[model samples]
Target: MTVNNIAATFLLGGIALSTQAQADFLRDGKATLGLKNFYFNNDSREGAAKPSKTEEWAQGFMLDYKSGYTDGVFGFGVDALGLLGVTLDGGKGRSVGSTMIPVGSDDRPVSQWGRLGLTGKVKVSRTELRYGTLLPRLPVLVANDGRLLPQTFEGGQVVSRELANVTFNGGRIEHATGRGSTDRTGLAAVGGQRESNQFNFAGADWRVSRDLLAQYYYGHLEDYYSQQFFGLVHTLEFSNDQSLKTDLRYFRTESSGKNSSGAAGYRISGYTKEGDGEIDNRTWSAAFIYSIGSHGVTAGYQSVSDGSNFTQLNQGGLEGKGAGGASLYLYTDRLTQSFTRAGERTAFGQYAYDFTALGVPGLKASMMYLRGDNIKTVSGDRLKEWERDFSLDYVVQSGALKGVGLGWRNGKSHSQAARNQDQNRVFLSYSIALF
Candidate 1:
């Protein structure tokens, strides 16, 4: 049967079971509706290639429902998500790229589009098994939510927390729905067209001490690559309400199966080893943050090996395949560019302030700057780049619209090897709960 048919069957079956089960199944249920109005604009600076500008505006609706488990040793539950997007103002020339909305045959944004996702779950003690649509937040993969809607994966996952101070996660994903598309596509790397049906991952998070945490994860994409990740996080607190946080991450990736020999149409884009277009790379980063009351400062450094660009689940190369934008699990993944080129080194710093310290609650601002250099290119040219970003956010502190939020973000980047660009975004959002 088709995926849609399977999803419908799961939805109908869940409803039937919930209706006949104990009252706890429905009594403990919860639902929420979220509304968002978004505006996005990007301008390519002078001397840049491609279109000079792209602009779009849209409204989004998200309905989420989660049901509690039934009364039994092995409990059952269900979750449903409904997403809708409407174009407020956008045309063919302004919506050429699938930034916030998908483009149609006429190269214009569709009037409106939506999708429904459902998952059936079973719980036993502290362990849960879930099947169907999933939005996973793991070190190996992160669901993209930078647009009107969040990306989702199709498959099954198991999460267990039976051990104290430890959590385990494992899953198999077969398909993905882009944040801006209504259709689902098979899993593939950024520049690869051969789809892989088996993307398997397993990971565990361990809390070694009160202020220290460690993580390890392994991922394998059939005929593509295999990857391993290690992470460490620690925080130091002082009596004067001051704290220091440290984060370290590393990844080791190598090609597998068809990609190892550059056969079966499995080829990677960009720079790689001279022999074949195979994947082999190491990337790592370290970040430190200092916080005192409402004021915060951060500094970070990252490096990429000389073998190839950092690899992740990017579908930008799969045009007309229902996938568009993607995100990487790195601190250098920014608004204008990702500093993951081969042999690149990046240094970044940021400062943030919360207005509550100045008697203005629910207001905050932050600014960041990043500089990268020593980038390795196919022609052995050393490239350099930099970006600066600023953001402001405010929320209604009281009255009828107490929870309403407004945000603005602006970024500019200049590079010797990439495009120079400026981007801005504005968002208004609110959420209501129904129990």
Candidate 2:
């Protein structure tokens, strides 16, 4: 159904339900107001166009309301999200590449912008159907939330848990509103200019045991590409607060329709087999994490096939600047770069510590590094790159400021395929319950 139809369903359901049902819906409903103050700065060290730096500060507000399903064999409910962003600083030159703020006609940052979203939902037995605004976190499509506001999609999704040890998910996504945008746009690949209004996906997760899970998913973007994903995760517990976790992921992707025919607007960008711009790639990664006490160490290796760069849904090449942010379900999707170039091989490691054992119950810190080499270049050369990232976060555990969170992140990247840059972000956030 269309967005309008979904909205109408919410309205009509509210009015048509019996008084007892309405009472149940409202009784179990909840609302929250979230606040975030963010500051971002990115300095291009080399190999970038003019306006070598992007700096901005902003305040964000989000209101979330969720209603419980009515009391009946078939239940109905609704959810609403309200997002607002106000620029505290930065304009024109300094805001060039800041994706958290919107730009205006004169190439300046907009003072403020806001949007509202609604979702209609229905439930029966152990299955649920939701339509309208969505934030999907599946293997093929991950809604971006790296900025002040999160990316949202216009679509319909169904999740079922009728099976004892398995869960099923499927969806059809038609459009997206970027994390920094107030308008919705069609979906496309990272460098694709043409819009593909239909994206179909289905997936299933099976819990094999108490500590092991298996997943399989398929996604198809009309006229663009199709992909299949397989994943496995397991955790092993040891003595003395020690544990080991293993995660394995694999993806196979290939061109379809226009993309397969090498059409201009539908073809992907970046290195491809014979420079044909076709989508053909196999990517995989495996990570192992060992935790002891309050410390965790992780190591992983990833590989991208030589035929083409890994592909997923991205709207960066679309018309709006805010349309550029996207998130990938890869360990390599870091703060500054995604090691996804064709023929790339990357090794990454991370060290994280929680301060709870050290008397600071709300503090945590992490450091990560990734090095990628053997990146295929169109000129038949191999390129290499590396990145280092650091993060520190704290949340108040008690008192008046309980649940208030503060965070700082820093990343430096040196790359042969793109610009070298240093980036920093600081944010403070809190959420208030509302009846």
| Candidate No. with top TM-score | 2
- Residues 1-435 of candidate 2: C-alpha lDDT, one tens digit per residue: 678578668857776889999987899899999999999999998864977888989999999999988999988899999999999998788885337888887879899988888899889999999998899999999999998888999999999999999999998999998887887889898789999899999999999999999999999999999999999999999976999999999999999989999898888888898788899999999999999999999999999999999999999888654688899999999989999999999999999999999999999999999999999967654899999999999999999999999999999999989889899999999999999
In candidate 1, stretches whose alpha carbon ends up further than 4 angstroms from where it belongs are 1-20, 46-49
Q: Least accurate stretch of 10 residues (summed lDDT) in model 1?
A: 11-20
Instruction: Output the worst ten-in-a-row residue range by lDDT, candidate 2.
Output: 96-105
Alpha-carbon local distance difference test for all models: 0.86, 0.92
Assess every candidate by TM-score: 0.96, 0.98
Cα lDDT for residue 266, candidate 2:
88
Question: CA shift at 376, candidate 2, in angstroms?
Answer: 1.0
Model 1 per-residue lDDT tens digits across residues 65-143:
9987777787777788999999998787887545888888888898887889888788899999988889988888888
| Clashes per model (N, Cα, C within 3 A) | 0, 0
Task: lDDT for model 1, please.
Answer: 0.86
